[model samples]
Target: MQELQQHLEATEQRLDAFLVKLTQRAQELLNGFEQEAVNIRRNDTIYGQAYSRFLAATRGQVQKLREKVKEVEETQIMPVFYRHCTQSSLAGFSSMVYEWRNRCQAKILQWEEQLYASESAAIERAEWQDYETVFQSHLQQYHAEKEKVYCKQCGAKLAINQVYYYTVYITCTFCQTQNIFNPGTSARQLEDTARKLAEQRSRPVLEQQQFYQQRERDLYMQAHELQLSLIHEKNNQIIKEKQQAIARLEEQRQEAVVKAPQLMEEYHRSVFDELNNLLPDLREHHEKFYRAITTHYQ
Candidate 1:
């Protein structure tokens, strides 16, 4: 019983060390995820070039982490578990080892569970919703600010939502002179951007101006609603699918955790099998080494 207890404690210590290594690698994976989050902002029109490189680097790191985990599992964890599970030891100790192996398996399962939960927290739906809701509200304020404008020509007071381009010409009813209005500073740079010339320079340019004003209002409404409309669509959209990418990355982390032990055990056992295959040939060499050492005493 005492011998069995010692073996059981030794097994636990081995598993504990493996767990510590697993925890450290899992933290590295989490840090990579956080770094990606910082690089990719929600409102970016395109993924930053640096972030594109980061994704590739992150995959390499995750693959390396998996390899390390496999090494630990095969080299440290499986030997302990197999030693207890096989019951080649004292008759009473087999039962104790069986219990110890089961306990070790439980610890492995718990490690995977904790890792999955940690990764999932990074891409959780509720948190994504919160991030977008705040951004959408801020975007709303931005739209409201852009909508406050008036016609510089007639001072006729354009609608709250006017789509002023680079340069537009308007005629005042009170005065009959053409007034060139540049609603925004960039109008001079992109002066020819508009397809129509202030309603094609028609006599009733005021009505044309009103038409353009209404068109701008419609566009503004669309832009504002769309920003808030498809948080889910944005997740799946081919161009800026940040949310989906993050979710996929989280799944990869979870997969690594779940597969770590099983993969290690399979590979670890194979390594031992290879050693066993060479053992018969090695026995002659082993004896020669022993005899060589014993000859020194003679």
Candidate 2:
């Protein structure tokens, strides 16, 4: 019993020390990845290369740590605990080993999630900035030509107050004719550009909203999966009760799913609101475009 106790104590201490070292190593890997991220543009091919390497390296480290935990559990901890199975105190040592394994696994999962989120956010921001640059260029071109609209009815130049995406009836100063001005495809495309820019800007908020919506879906799927597994059982009465429980879960899921469109509606409103703010001069066009798209949702 004394020797078993000594072995358990030594194993626990060694495992604890291993966990500390694993954590340090993981942090070191993360630090290196972050340093690479600082130098690489998210849109560049190099960014993907760096990310793949980082992911592989981190996953390898995690796998190694997991294998070490399992090794210790099977070869050292379990053997010692089983040899002294009659000793009740040895059960606590077994529990300690299990807890350590769970903790380590949990930490690894958390680190991976954090890394993924960081990468996603970085990519999103980079795309947003790229769109912003394009929008600014379009804006500059729009302003420079705002007063350059020539009256098709007469040779007179029309001093337009704002950018028009669609056909506008502008009274000619010289001919006094209502010249139907269509700003052509290039100008019409600016509305699309503005809309895309706004969407990119609000992507993070949309993603957050989508995350909860996805979570609800995942919960429903998990419950449905459980219900399917239970259906395979031989018991009839228990299956009936389980089916009823799953039905309730499905009902709840339906309720949540019904609310999903409203969330999308909110996101759309937010995107257009942002669009209007970005190009307040085109508010009328933006509102018309918003109404045109949202009518289907309604």
User: What TM-scores do the predictions have?
Assistant: 0.37, 0.48
Cα lDDT tens digits for candidate 2, 1-298: 3665466567667766765676577556656655555555464575367656655665566567557656765786556545665456666455444444444444444444544555455444433446788787887777666567787767788867777777889888788878777777656557778889888877777776677676666557557555545634778888887788888877777766876676778888989999898878888877888898899778
Total clashes in model 2, counting residue pairs 3 or more apart in sequence or in different chains: 0
User: On a 0 to 100 scale, what is the lDDT of residue 53 in model 2?
Assistant: 67
Q: Compare the candidates by TM-score and give the number of the best one.
A: 2
TM-score, predicted candidate 1 vs. hidden true structure: 0.37
Clashes of each: 1, 0
lDDT by residue (1-298, candidate 1, tens digit) is: 6865786688678768877887788777777677655646443456356555655565566556556655766676678667656765565455555556555655665566566556655433212333224333543543454445445655564443333433566554555556665556333212221112211222143334344443443444344334333332534564355445545545554554444444434433343333223233333433564456445533
- Judging by lDDT against the true structure, name the best candidate: 2
Q: How far is candidate 1 from the true structure (C-alpha RMSD, Å)?
A: 31.0
Query: What is candidate 2's CA lDDT for residue 21?
Result: 78
Give RMSD to native, each candidate. 31.0, 11.3
Candidate 2 lDDT score relative to the true structure:
0.66
